[model samples]
Target: MISNNIKIKTQDLNVYYGEKQALFNVNLDIHSKEVTALIGPSGCGKSTFIRCINRMNDVIDICKIDGSIKIDDKEIIDNNVDVVRLRESIGMVFQKPNPFPKSIYDNISYGPSIHGLADNKSDMDKIVENSLKKAALWEEVKDRLDEPGTGLSGGQQQRLCIARAISVNPEVILMDEPCSALDPIATAKIEELIDELKKSYTIVIVTHSMSQAVRVSQRTGFFHLGKIIEVDTTEKIFKNPGNQMTQDYITGRFG
Candidate 1:
């Protein structure tokens, strides 16, 4: 169930890559324990918007962001913020499943180990098991924990990545088109995982698939040309959007 509490808030958010602006005065509020989906055409800044939540854009030296991003009503855009700790609390799953070449167990244990969430081998073992179970991949790979994560099938590898994300016990999860590379069955499984995960973690997803947004999200924000055109309940956005551009886009008239 979605909480009334706001988990993340952004106001007047703008992004530029060497003077090429990517986002424009974006303002959004994400509710706690809910799936908030961002939908847009290509290059519309959907991915850029979610990346800002975890400060993933900092990797690009040319990128410059100026705005207010608050998590739990605390400013995160400040220079004084501990970025590593912020990222530990917000996990990200990218469009492609890029698991490390290490073993499946290592993949799940890596985050907890780095964060010092476990004291001993036994504690790490429990964290790995629980994370895999949460990701719905434990039964499939429990016997092959020593196998390389890259050895798994694409779907399994993606699940392994998800397990790694949750192993750190993040309060929020950001998925950038997580199902784009997946087959329908795999996509369904991931959607189900999102449904289950929303009970414990706030979720933000960027998707080009409108059906997917409707299926997995409680609230939807429509972005176009680096700006959010409309934001409302998923049902409202799909069935009765206030903006003609949004309606046209949803109806396949134009992107």
Candidate 2:
């Protein structure tokens, strides 16, 4: 069942990169303050779907998006929509930890500085500290704020990227295979952080790890051939999916 507390709504969201349609007539209602995980084999349009939420596909000259993506009923596809503000409202963390070649403190403060969320050093400092604390990295890196972000361990770097995402106080955070490059221990920390983060921010994650999806998300969507074949509570999707294709994919058939 779709929740009444829908934070993001996508209707007939179709994307075409040049001549290839990457997504097909997709409709999804993402709930507020919840983690929704997208799972599928590669090339299933999972990343493309989330990128559409923030209009990231606009960068590609031939990327054509036809449909509606709304946050609180405000259509994001409108030509007049300020993409910078939109992106600030909906932050993204990519597959690998891609930290800027700046100090740890600078990395956390970059978004707030760009969006004018902080006006003074004190406010920026608080924002930086709180964001790191939220990502659970403050304790480890608090004294090393001057160190370059790129120098951190892989897991720490990914957490740093996450802190940067939340630094802007985004309404929603989109993570694309965020833990793919981390070790089991590092992945565990990121997973724990994701669970805690959903209490304050809506989150959407695209991961190939079915176990990760099961562990981190309340609702799970199974995508296949550029479409979502099934979506339901994680338990049901894993153990009792309604679609055979979904069952096949989850059971390690043809995914």
Candidate 3:
């Protein structure tokens, strides 16, 4: 059943790269102001599914997508869509921390500046501070805004990237293996941040860690070989999955 709170919806969604198919009729509904986690083994098309949300797949020369993707009930697969503006409303954080080679201030302010989100220097400064604070890195990096973003430690750099994503005031945030490279403590911090961020933004995360998915998400979707085998509330999916494959994968029997 499709809920009235659905923030993003995909129906009969299919994706391809040249002659190879990456996704197969993926249908998922992400609720507003909630965290939805996608979990699967390697090469299961989990990342491909989220990439389709913001049309990031459009960059690949051979990529072709069909079917329907809607945000706020508006179709986005059409060529007439404003991609730049579409991207502005949907933020993405990648697997690894890939901050620009610029200073922390520039990193956060760049999106707002290009999008004309700030009117003056003071406004930009405020956006930078607020974004960093939201990402829980303001207290740590506030004193060093002029320093290069890449200079921060791994966890701090990841937080900075999160801040950069939120700086543009996106309504939806997509994270693909956001904590894959971080240590345990760093992963916990990111998890905490995700919890807080979901209060204001719709978050979709692709994760390989079952524990992480249970901890951070309200809804969980299990993908296998380019198809979604099951999706349910996180508690139900973890404690008692409806599919045998889901049960096996979560139990370490098979991936």
Candidate 4:
């Protein structure tokens, strides 16, 4: 069951890529301390919608957005909105693990240092340790924090990215097909991490794997042709969907 602690809300949200409408009116409520899965075919607006939550869309020159998305009752799309602060409050992990070329320690501490979240070297070390621990990568990398982040395997690098994101202590974490580039074992590890991370952060994941969605999410939203067709409990979305498009996509009939 989803709690009443809504961390983010999207009302009549729409997106455009230089006159090409990518998302229609997308209304969504993401509860705090829960995992919500967005599932749809490629080119669907699932990824676009998640990017909007953290203001990543602002980077694309052709991308334009309308409607309201609120975080902690604050409008994120408003002109005076602090985009830097908004990004700090909402962290994102992309489909591929994009660790910096710097040392593993540097990767985790980068955000905290930039945001002035750490007071000193000791504080920075503590932040790195706690974030890596929370991301379940401490056991593997605790002995080699100085090594380049790319030295790790795909899964470890992804977790390192997660650690970096969490180091800022963001309120919400957006994952866009985080396991797509990982092997089965690596994917499983990430899935477990997602289940645990939900205890502290609101998670919104866009995944192509139905089983992954069913396993890790409390709620599911089905998208098709740039519109959300159904939003419900994970079980309901998989076992019984309200929309035919959702049902078809879930049953593997068609994307």
Lowest lDDT 10-residue stretch of candidate 3: 1-10
Give the C-alpha lDDT of model 3.
0.95
Tens-digit lDDT string for candidate 4 (1-255): 588888999999999999899999999999999999999999999999999998899999999999999988889988899899989988999999999999999999999999999899999999999999999999999999999999999999999999999999998999999999999999999999998999999999999999999999999999888998899999999888888888888898993
Q: Which segments of model 2 are wrong by more than 4 Å?
A: 1-3
lDDT of 2 at 197: 95
| 54-103: candidate 3 lDDT, tens digit per residue | 99999999999999999999999999999999999999998899999999
- After aligning candidate 1 to the native by TM-score, how far in Å is the CA of 54 from where it should be? 0.7
Name the regions of candidate 3 deviating beyond 4 angstroms.
1-4
lDDT of 1 by residue, 189-250 (tens): 99999999999999999998999999999999999999999999999999999999999998
lDDT of 2 at 250: 82
Q: Write the per-residue lDDT of candidate 2 for residues 1-255, one digit (tens) a residue.
A: 234599998999899999999999888989999999999888999999999999999998999999999998899999999999999999899999999999999999888998999989999999999999999999999999999999999999999999999999999999999999999999999999998999999999999998899899989988887887888888899979999998998888973
TM-score of the candidate numbered 4?
Answer: 0.98
Window of ten residues with lowest summed lDDT in model 4: 246-255
Query: Whose lDDT is greatest here?
Result: 3
Question: Where in model 4 is the C-alpha error above 4 Å?
Answer: none
Taking all chains together, the TM-score of candidate 3 against the true structure is 0.98
